[model samples]
Target: MSNNLALNIEKIKKEKSGIDVLADIYFHAVFGEKISPENLERFKWYGIYAQDEQQNYFSIKIPLNMGELNLIQLKTLSLISKQFSDDSLIFSNEQKIEFKNIKIFDLPKIFKLLQEVNLNTFFEAGHTVRRVLTCPVNGIDKTQLIDVEPLANKLNETFIGNKKFENLPNKLQIAISGYEEGCDVQFTPDVSFNAIKDSKEKILFNVKILGNSIGFISPSQVLKTAIAIANIYKDFGERDDVEKSSFEYLVKNLGLIRFYDILNSTINYKIQQSSFKNEISHPRKPRLGINESKIEGQSYIGCKIYDRVVQSSKLDNLSSLLEKYEANRVKLTHKGNIIILDVPTLNAQNLACELEKISFNPFV
Candidate 1:
C-alpha cells in the first residue's frame, strides 16, 4: 500500500474538526434526532462512544486534570454515576474516568453533571493529544525531587480544545514525573519527561521519545517543545494507515537522529544532546498501602483497586469518608489505585480501616 494515500479518517478530519461536534451532539441527544454515521465517529472527540450497533447506548470518558479531584468533585461524579450509569465507574490507566451502559438521552445530563465540577469531556479522545499523565504523587510524594504538578496542569490546560491541535494525524500520549528514581512505573508514554539533576545540582527534565531519551530541556521550554512536537507530527506523520499512524511509529520509521533533527528545527532552539550523565533507575515496588506524604504529620492511603472497577455506592462511601477524615483530595494513580491524600497522621489508621471495609483494600 502506498503511504502517500490519505485514509478515510484523515478525510473525515479535514471535513470538520472533531471538537465542533457539540451541536450535532445536542441535536441528536437532546432532540432525539437520528445521528449520521460520520457524526457517530465524531462523537469520540467528546469522549462519547456507542456501546451497540443500534447506537442507543454510550460510554463516556472524563479526563481528570492530573487525576486530582476534591471532595465535591468526587461526590458529584459518584452522584452522576448513581443517577445516569449502571452504578459503576471504570478508571483507565491514563487516570481518566469512564461510565458505561449510558442511554443516548442521558449523555448531556451527564456532561452537565461534569460541568458542575469543572470537568469536561472535550479532547478526552479523538486524534489529538489524550490525557496528559503525571506522577500520581506529584507534589505529595516524599521522593519527588521537583513538583511537576503545576507544570503538568499547565500543559494540560494549554492544549486541550486548542484549535491548532484538533486534527492531528493520530493521538499522542505524554507522561511526566517528578519521581527521582521513576519507581513502580507501569508504562511508557509516546513522550516522557523524567526529572533529573544536572552536575550543578539544578533540576531539569530528561525528555524521551517513545521511551528512549532524546535529550534534556529546561522547565520553561516544556510547553514550547510539546507544541513543536505536535506541529511536526501534524505536518509529516503518515495518514494512509490508521493502525500505523502513531507518533511512536513515525519516530521509529524516521529514526531518532532524523526525528530529533526535525524536532530541533521545528522548535528553533538547541536541545541538549543525549549525552547527559543522568541515569533513570529501574522501577521498584508499587506505592501500596498507607504512606507518609511530603508534609510532616500528614499521610495518604493507597487503596488498590482490583480490575479498575468501583461501584458508585463504594465511591459514595469513599467520598463520605473523605469528609469525615478531612482528607485534602483524591488522586487516581496510573497503576489504577486510588490515593486519598493529605489525611492527618492522627486520622490515617481509622481512615485506612474504613477504606478497607469498603473493599478499597490498602493492605494489598
Candidate 2:
C-alpha cells in the first residue's frame, strides 16, 4: 500500500471511537474490500496502535495467554517492524506489545494486517494478570526443597481465565522462594511459599500469608502444602470489595481455622504443622560484599535498582560484567536486589568496584 493510503487508513481508525468499528473501518481501508462476520470474530484477539504528531503512541487492549509468542504474531510484528519507523518493538515491562513510531494514518492497514495474520492471539493488553509477576526460576532453584512453579502457574491460569478472580478486591501478589537467601520477592507478596530443608534433609514448604512491603509486614505461617495454600487463597480471597480484598485481609478477618476449612475441601493432603522457620535475614545497610552465598568463596552484591526500576541498559551492562568476571548467573532477589553468583576470588574486589560505580554495592 502507498504511504498516503496508510496515512488515511490510520486517520479513519483513530477518528472512530470503539475497537469493533475501528477494526471494521481498518479492514476495509487496508484491503480496499469488506470482511465477513466470521473473519471479524477471529480479529478480536489483535490490538490496534495509533501515533499522534507528538511521537506518542496508543495501544488497543487484547487478551491472550502468556506463553511463547506464536509464528503468526511474529510475522505480524515483522510486518509492523517494516512499516513503522523504528526496529524496536516495545514489550511493556508488564509483558505487553507496543507498536512504536507509527503514524496515525497507518493504523488501519496495520490493524488489518494484524487481523489477517491472526496476530491478536498473542497480544494481551490492559489485563489484570499483568500485575502478577513470577520468577522464571521459581521451581528450578537447586536450593529449593519443593518446586513452586507448578503452583504459581496454576494460580495464574485459574485467576486470569476464571471470571471469579477478575473481581478480586485488591491486586494480589504471590511468590515462591527456595534457598536460605530467597530469590523470589517473598516479603513483598501478599502470599509467599518458601522452601525449607530440615535436619534430615526432608524438604517442606511454609506458606506465608498477608506479607506486604509496607509497614504491615506481618508474616504468618499457614499451609505446608503449596496446593492447599493456593486453594486457601482462592476460597477465602474476597472478590466483592476490591479495596478490602487480598489474602491478608481475608486471613486477618476470618482467622486461621475458618480459612483452612475453605481450602481443605479442595486439597487432598493433610495440613501439617509448619516446620518452616523464618530463616531469612533482615536487610542490612547498603554496602558491598556483606552477604555470602551458599557456594564457598562466592559472595553477593546488592544493587539498589534506580527507584526500583529495572532497565535494559543496566541489565545489559551487568550481563557483560558477569561474563567478564566469570560470574555464572545473575539472580534477581525478591527485595529488588540482584545477585551475581560464583564470583572468583581474584576478580571479587574489582567486580565490587565496578558494580559500585553502577550503583550496586557488593555485600559487605
Candidate 3:
C-alpha cells in the first residue's frame, strides 16, 4: 500500500484480472500456482471472504439482489455450507450469503459450482461498489409501492464489473428502494434513493447523501443519477489517507450542499428539492412474521438468524424445508432474517414450525 505501484490500496491486483486469476489459481495449482500476497488481498473484491481477523479459512459473500434466492440457488448455498463451511449459511446484514471456513485450495471449484446456479461472489467487499441493496419485500409485500428490483439489478450491472469504479477513495455504499416507508438501511448509505411523492403525488425518489436529503429524481433518471453521483465520488472523494477517504468522510468534509451541488453539476441537471419530509428509523421491521404478499393467497415467512453466525447443517435443513413445503424463493432481510417467499396461506404455519425445528423460529 505504501509503495509507488498504486496510490490506492484497493486496486493493487494488476498482474491479472482478479476473477480470471481465481480460475487460474483453481486449475493451475498443480503447476505451482501460488497465491501471492496481493492476490490474497484482492480476493475480497470478488466477495472472497478470507480475512485477517478470521485467518487461514475464507468466506465467500454472495450478494442477493433484494435478497432474492431461487430454489436452485438455495440448494447451491446448502451444498456450499454442507461441504465447505460445516452446515451453516451465515446471513449478512446486507442481505447476502456468507460461506465461511472454506479452504483456499477449494475456492475455484466452489466458484465454478456457484456459477452453475447463476451466482458469483463478485464485488461484495473492498473499496469497490459493494452490494446493491433494495427493499427485501420487493414484489411480495403490500407496503412496497414500486418493485425496485430492476433498478437494483441495473445498478449492480452498471457498477459491479466496471474497472473505473474499482479504485474509488473507499467503499461507496448505495441503496435504491421503492419502499414509501423506507426499508433497507436507508440513512446509513453514502448515497440512498427512497421513493416518495411530489406535489402531483407521482412517485419519484428523494436522493439523500450521508443521511441528509439533497433532492429528488424521477424513476427513469435514477440510473443516471446514480452514475453521476458515483462519478462525483470518484472525482472528488479524497484519497490521501485512504482510511479517512470514505464517502461519508468526503460528505462530512465537503459539507452536504457542496456535495449535493457537485452531484447535480455532474449529471448536468438540477435536482428539485423534495416537498416530502420523513426520517425512517426501523432498521429491523418485518424481521419475523408471516408477511402477506401484495398478491392475495400468498405469504412470506421470515425467520431471525444470527447476523454473522449460522450452522451449515441448519441452512441445509432450511433449503430442504423450502423444497418440502413447495416454496419457490427465499429473500434475506436487512435485519438478518430470512424470508421464504411465494408460500400458500395454508402452508404458512407449517413453514414456521419447520423453521422452528431448526431453531430459527419465525413466530418469535
Question: Of the candidates shown, which would achieve the greatest TM-score relative to the real structure?
Answer: 1
Off by over 4 Å in 2: 1-170, 179-188, 197-201, 211-238, 273-292, 295-299, 305-316
Superposition error at 52 for model 2 (Å)? 13
lDDT of 1: 0.81
229: Cα error in model 1, Å: 0.8
Candidates' lDDT values, in order?
0.81, 0.46, 0.74
Alpha carbon lDDT of residue 12, candidate 1? Answer: 70
- Candidate that beats the other on TM-score, 1 or 2, i.e. the better one: 1
| lDDT, candidate 1, 286-332, per-residue tens | 47688998899899888888867788888888888888888959888
Q: Estimate, for each residue in 1-364, the C-alpha lDDT of model 3 and write its tens digit.
A: 5554335354564455454445544553335444556666577677874455434677788877667889888777777877777777677778878877777777777878889998877777766777677776777777666878888888988988688777677778888777654564524777788887767879899787766677778898888998887888888887766667788888788887777667777776779874333455553255467877787888888777754577756666777887788788888778677778788888888888878878776876
Models 1 onward score TM values of 0.93, 0.49, 0.88
Write down the RMSD of candidate 1 (Cα, Å): 2.8
- What's the CA RMSD of model 2 in angstroms? 11.1
lDDT, candidate 2, 1-364, per-residue tens: 3344322332332343222344564654455444433333223323443334232443443332222234345445655655663543443332344555555456666656767854442213211222234442333334445555455555555554344433233345555555433443334555555556667766655555553211111112222343354445555666545445556677768775565556455656544544233334542222335345445666655454443433335444565676678775543443445545566767777888888777666634
Candidate 2, residue 224: how far the Cα is off, in Å: 11
Minimum summed lDDT over a 10-residue window in model 2 is located at 212-221
